[model samples]
Structures are given as structure tokens and as C-alpha cells.
Target: MSLPAPETPLYNHPLPQLERWLMALGCQQDRGDRHCWLLHQGDWDAELSLDTEELVICYFPHQPQRKVVRSFKYSLSRQDVEAAVLEGP
Candidate 1:
């Protein structure tokens, strides 16, 4: 399905469109958990979870043994979340 404009709030998109957007960003859905997605770049890995009211992201090894976690409310514009997430931790 086609998605809304990038400036539109995420809450305005349908679930499948959101999933597609994530997939377009090179994220793979967790096989065991439909609500979770995973992404790996050359230098880092991240897990993104679709929560009840927000999208949560955890980046591995923000430090030697720690993961950096961040959350974005669904009310934010799709472009804003995309920029923040693509920026990495």
C-alpha cells in the first residue's frame, strides 16, 4: 500500500505501511516476535520494537557492555523518526 507523506505523523499510517517503511530501511522483522525488528550496519546493530504507544530502539554496544535505548512517540512525523533513527546512537 502507498504511504502517507513523510511529513505526516506516524499514527496516520496504516500498520502495514509502517512495516513496509521499516523494511525499506533495511530492517528485518524478528521471526519470533512480530512487533520487533532488527537492523545491522557495518559498525552497529539495533533492535526496534513497536510498543503500544511508541517505537523503541536499542542500539548494541553504545559502550562496551551497554546498549543505548531510545523511544519515539507515534505522534511524531514519519520523517522526523526516520531521520533520528537513521542518524544512529
Candidate 2:
């Protein structure tokens, strides 16, 4: 039940759409009551967190607070992420 074809490029995806897509990707609940969620991928060794106001992706291999951040309106698609780089919360 996912949209946005993998090949599809992203400019900006609404927060609701991105949130739903994230939930479907096994995003662990950080604060479900507050809309904060985190997704971890062992293979990539990366963790991404998103809430109502921000998106943050941290590379475990890097230093702390070195996460990528973006506006809540940022797109969740790979293309958008790659283009914007990982954003801070």
C-alpha cells in the first residue's frame, strides 16, 4: 500500500504522506502519542527520525549531533533526501 514509485523523483512531499510512508517502512515508535518515529536499517547502519516539525537522519558511524535536518515539509523520497542530504531535527 505504498505510493511514489521507487524510480519517481521527489521535490517535496506533504508531511502526512511522508509520515504514512515512514510508518509502512517499519519506523519504530519513539513517541507514538506525539508523532515522533524512528526507522533503523542495520544494513545501512542509519537511523531516521521524524515528527511534526522536523526530520533527522543520523549516521551511526559519524559523530553525534551530526544528523541531517529538514523542514517538516521536506519530501521523504530518496531523491529528495539525497538532494537535500540528511537533515537535522
Candidate 3:
């Protein structure tokens, strides 16, 4: 009998999966860094970074007054991260 491979956790999804997940939400990789990405919709834009322990996101890049920064643990589900990131501050 063949054994099934263990399932990967959401936070542990491969880089390609991560890229696809972000792209599906209209986000694109930053030209300068593969770990960095940007998403734009209407007048709002967000920058995201995939770090070792967390996913860091900044909403409203230039305007300090309206900007919001959030970090999510890698243990969280992909849907949780998406909801938090896509929901504007």
C-alpha cells in the first residue's frame, strides 16, 4: 500500500503557492524584492512582506495619517491573512 504524504500547513505553504494566493487578490511582486509585494484597488494600495515568522502588511504606503501596519503569524490560515490584509484600516 502506498502511504499519503503529510499535509502542509497554510503558513508553511510553498513560495509559489504564496505568490499565487497574493496574485489572486490583485497583488504583484515588487521589482526590487521577491519577498515584497504590492496590491492596488481603486485609490488604496498596500505593501506586504513575507518574513520568517510573520507576514507584515502596510496599508496606505505614503500617507502616514491614513496608514496602517499589521503583522500576522505564519500559523494563521491563508483566508485569515487575506481577510485581514484586504480589509482596509
Q: Compose the digit string of candidate 2's lDDT tens values, residues 1-89.
A: 35666445343455576666666666655664445565555433345655444555555433455444344234445456544433323
Rank candidates by TM-score, best first.
1, 3, 2
Best by lDDT: 1
What's model 2's lDDT at 36? 55
Worst 10 residues of 3 by lDDT: 1-10
For candidate 3, write residues 1-89 as lDDT tens digits.
22112243456677787787778789999988989999986656888998988999888854456788899887787767777787766
Question: What local distance difference test score does each model get?
Answer: 0.93, 0.51, 0.77
Please provide TM-scores, in order, for all candidate models, with all chains considered together.
0.93, 0.42, 0.80
lDDT (tens digit, per residue) of candidate 1 on 1-89: 78899999999988999999999999999999999999987667899999999999998854576788999999999999999998888
Q: How many backbone clashes does candidate 3 have?
A: 0
TM-score of 2: 0.42
lDDT of 2: 0.51
Q: Is candidate 1 or candidate 2 better by lDDT?
A: 1
Model 3 stretches astray by more than 4 angstroms: 1-9, 61-64
Distance from true location, Cα of 20 in model 3, Å: 0.7
Identify the superior model by TM-score, candidate 1 or candidate 2: 1
